[model samples]
Target chain A: MTAAELLSLTATISLVILGIAMLIAIIRVVIGPTLSDRILALDLLTVIAMGFVAAIAIRTGLMLYLDIAISLALLGFLATVALARYMLSRIKDEDDQP
Target chain B: MTALLATVLGCILLLLGSCFALLGAVGVLRLPDLYTRMHAASKAGAVGGGMILVAVALVSFDASIALRAVIGAAFLLLTTPVSAHLLARVSHRGGYHTQTTMFIDELAAASPSKGTLEQ
Candidate 1:
């Protein structure tokens, strides 16, 4: 296969693999027994989604999508951190109780 | 020749990264307890995702794509450990359950007000 064909082929396969990973992460979020589990799954999901965006950017030969992927990477950390802080405050409240 | 070489390298990296991602996803399910699973998903997921970014940069070989990919990968590497530590701290404080084999309470030990938080 030619160079373009090879890159596109790899992009397709990578997308398929990332799709599977994202699916499993979604399942965990839906059925996770603990708050942390669900939060972690959400984080993983965002990262996987960014990977999807990156793969698409590659396959389509678009540099602009890379900007989206970068912002997603930066912004995704906010959710996990916020949830963890919420949990921390709840624990502190519990500790404060008589 | 360089084009072919770059494609081969990018393909290899992409596939390897995807495998790492798949491993982390599976570990998220297979592992017991929030902490261990955190170890699995956070670290592996970040590394895998970073690898993919690198692969994308290699394939494109342009200034804009490479710059953004590098920034993204650096952001991921930096934030992953912070988030994982935060998650662990929250879980420890929230009294999340752990498996029987996990018997180290280092954080609780440091606090001194600790009174058998392990389950």
Candidate 2:
């Protein structure tokens, strides 16, 4: 019932929840019917990963880990944008076929 | 006393944030179509991640660390919607038309081509 105990308890629970979320997102990535679905699932995975990183930082009391979370957010955005552009080009190429 | 209060607040934030994240994952897994899945993944997922980041800021209680955490959360919030919009537009242009079960087709209705919107 101490505050430190409460903090650790919540941190552990958060980690468990994030892990399950990541698993579900992986399932979507594996069985998603379309390319967009898969990409969307991947994006969810990255967000879940961010939550994991934050939870760990809270547990460890290492505030520096937040830097990794920041970098990850940027990287995920770039990756999603790149994938979308790739999908667009592929579709355009298909249309150009005689 | 102040330390205890901070810890208590941090714990609540952590639990709330994680539960939101779990809900987002479930929505992504169970939604019937790509568009609906995207809706859940983008909005809920972003909010969940941002909340956790904010929780990190609260627990740390260091001014510098708190700044970084808030910055990361804000960046996450800013980018998720843009990326979702990009994905949706690309999918639509790629001929991934909306399902027939849906009652509305705003893009198609607004487009001159009737069914397909312009790139």
Candidate 3:
């Protein structure tokens, strides 16, 4: 097979796998017992989304999509950090109540 | 020849990356506690996403694309750990610890007051 054909096939398969991973992360978020579990699952979901963007960049020959992936990573990190801090403050308040 | 080789390598990396991502997701879904779930998801997910980005760099064969791809991957690698640590620390302070899974409490031992607060 030609190189282009091989790359296309690989990207297709990768997209399928990433989609499955995304589904699993969603399941975790849905059933997670605690706030922390849901937040962790959400973080994984964003990372998998980045993989999706990368795979699309490979398939479509659009290098610009890599920029989207980078920006998404930055945003995801900021969101996770903010949520964690929120949880910390909430817990500290509960601790102080007693 | 170089193009073919690069494509082959990128294909391999793509497959490896997707598998790692799937593993992380499954771990997050199946792990018993928040800490173990974060342990599996954060490291594996970051590596998986980074590998896919690197695969993009390998196949593109252009300096600019390679630079952007590498930058994205590096950004992912650097940020994932920080977020994971923050989440873990918050959960620990919130008393999400599972007695069966955790054997020691080093952070708690270091600060007796914090340990008391955990309980």
Candidate 4:
């Protein structure tokens, strides 16, 4: 097989693997008992999504997907920070009640 | 010859990276505590995700695209640790205790207690 064909095949397989990983992360986000657990899962899901975008870019020969990956990364960071802040405020309130 | 070797090596690296990412997700799910889970999620996820990005860059062979992947990887590496640290600090201060920890927290002991207000 040609090198391009091989690379394409590899990209397809990697994308499938990444998709499964993202699914696992999603399950964690859904069933996590604690807020921190959910946030952690969500963060992972974003990273996996970034990987997926890269795979797609490789398969399709388009660079635009990289832009999408960057946006996802930024969003993930914001979400984690917001969750941390919320958790911190909640803890302070709980400390005050006793 | 070089092209064939690069393609095979890239595929192998990509596969390894996916495995690490899968393991990271499993760690996130199976680990017993928030801190440990975060350790797995952040470190494994960051490295695995970065490796996959590198593999993609190698396969594509476009300088701009590869640079973008590198940028994405850099961002992940930088952000994951800071976020994890923030979460851990917040959880600790919020009174979340590790389920299996055996030692008294010295930092908690060192802090002066808020004085009781007279009614």
Candidate 5:
């Protein structure tokens, strides 16, 4: 069909799909078997959120919220690294105990 | 002509990226263990997110949008793999394991005392 129709349709479908994905990741995070599993699910949630932000930016034609996506990308990475370091410190503590 | 072409391509790519993201979420839910699920979530999820950024670049009417989208996608590409690597290493260090590992634990085998690696 027309360009406007195609763009809007794509935006709707992608938003819906990423929404579902984010829900699934939340479920996993809630019942994940381990701390690491929960952390990974959180990471997935961030990725899905990025896609969601991108979809919104396109749908609204604002082009500004895409900046949010960039910030999320960096913030999510920092969070993951911080979590990993926390786990490492925990491990070292356990090692020192006995 | 070129505008229509780009719009069509952007739509297709956006759809594909969302599908990949959904697949990654399903994998995170269905996979038995942390490692395998991380494999799905980190790799496919990152690529899927990157594709969406590219689609945004393509669909947007302004060149500035494309520039921001590209920067965001590149940042995503750079950070995701590094974070995944750190997570996997931390999992190994923290004694996390997967049941369906049909392969050897080469990291442990190669380095018996994994403590020094992190130190």
Candidate 6:
């Protein structure tokens, strides 16, 4: 096969693998028993999504996907922090009761 | 040619990195406790994400994309640990005491009065 074909094939396989990772992360988000578990799952989900963005960038030879991936990363971090804060405050409220 | 070699190597690394990420998700599902799960998530997520980013950087052969990947990786590394710590601290404070396996409870010792109030 030609080099371009090889690159395309390789990129396709990697994207499929990343899809599997995303599925696993989604499963965790669905089944996690605790709030923290769900938050952790969300964190993984974003990272896997970023992987997909990277794969697309490589496959299509586009640079814009990289920007999208970075933005997703930032948003994911904010989500995690917000969840953590919420969990903390909820726990604190529970502690305050007699 | 060098390009073909790089593509092959990049694909292999991407697969490996995705495997690590998959394992991290599995770890999240299987770990017995919050701390252990966080450990798996942070370590695997950071490293796995980094590897995949590197693979993309290499495959694309673009300096700009590579720089963005590096920045994203850095952001993940910086944030994962802090979030994990916050969660752990909140869990501890919430009186979700570690099960019997916990040998030391520094937070408990540090705030004996609060412990009494909760009891």
Candidate 3 segments exceeding 4 Å error: B98-100, B112-119
Kindly list the per-residue Cα lDDT of model 1 for residues A1-98, writing each as its tens digit: 78888888988999999999989988888888777889999898888888888888888889788888878877779988998888777666667773
What TM-score does candidate 1 reach? 0.91
Residue A75 CA displacement from its true place in model 2, Å: 1.1
- TM-score for chain B of all predictions: 0.85, 0.87, 0.88, 0.82, 0.87, 0.83
Q: Per-prediction DockQ, in order? A: 0.59, 0.62, 0.67, 0.49, 0.61, 0.49
Best by DockQ: 3
Model 4 C-alpha lDDT per residue in residues B1-119, reported as the tens digit of each score: 77677667877877788888888988888888777888889888888878877776676667887787778778888988999889877765654553437366675566633322111
Listed in order, each prediction's TM-score against the native is 0.91, 0.92, 0.93, 0.86, 0.93, 0.86
> What tens digits encode model 5's per-residue C-alpha lDDT throughout A68-93?
88788778888989998998887787
Off by over 4 Å in 6: B99-106, B112-119
User: Relative to the unseen true structure, what is the C-alpha lDDT of residue B99 in candidate 3, on a scale of 0 to 100?
Assistant: 40
Query: Which is the winner by TM-score between candidate 3 and candidate 6?
Result: 3
Chain A TM-scores of all predicted models = 0.93, 0.94, 0.95, 0.91, 0.95, 0.92
The prediction achieving the highest lDDT against the true structure is: 3
How much of the true contact map at the interface does candidate 3 reproduce, as a fraction? 0.85
Q: What is the TM-score of chain A in candidate 2?
A: 0.94
Model 4 lDDT per residue over A1-98, tens place: 88778778888888888888899899888887777778889988988887788778767878787788778888988988998897776666656896
Query: Per-residue CA lDDT of candidate 5, range B4-99, in tens?
Result: 888888888899999999999999999988788988998889889999999999988689789889888888888888888898888887656433
The TM-score, computed over Cα atoms with residue i paired to residue i, of candidate 4 is: 0.86
State the local distance difference test value for candidate 4: 0.78
- Over the full model, what C-alpha lDDT does candidate 3 score relative to the true structure? 0.87
What is the lDDT for B60 in model 6? 72
Better of 5 and 6 by lDDT: 5
Q: Model 4 residue B102 lDDT?
A: 35
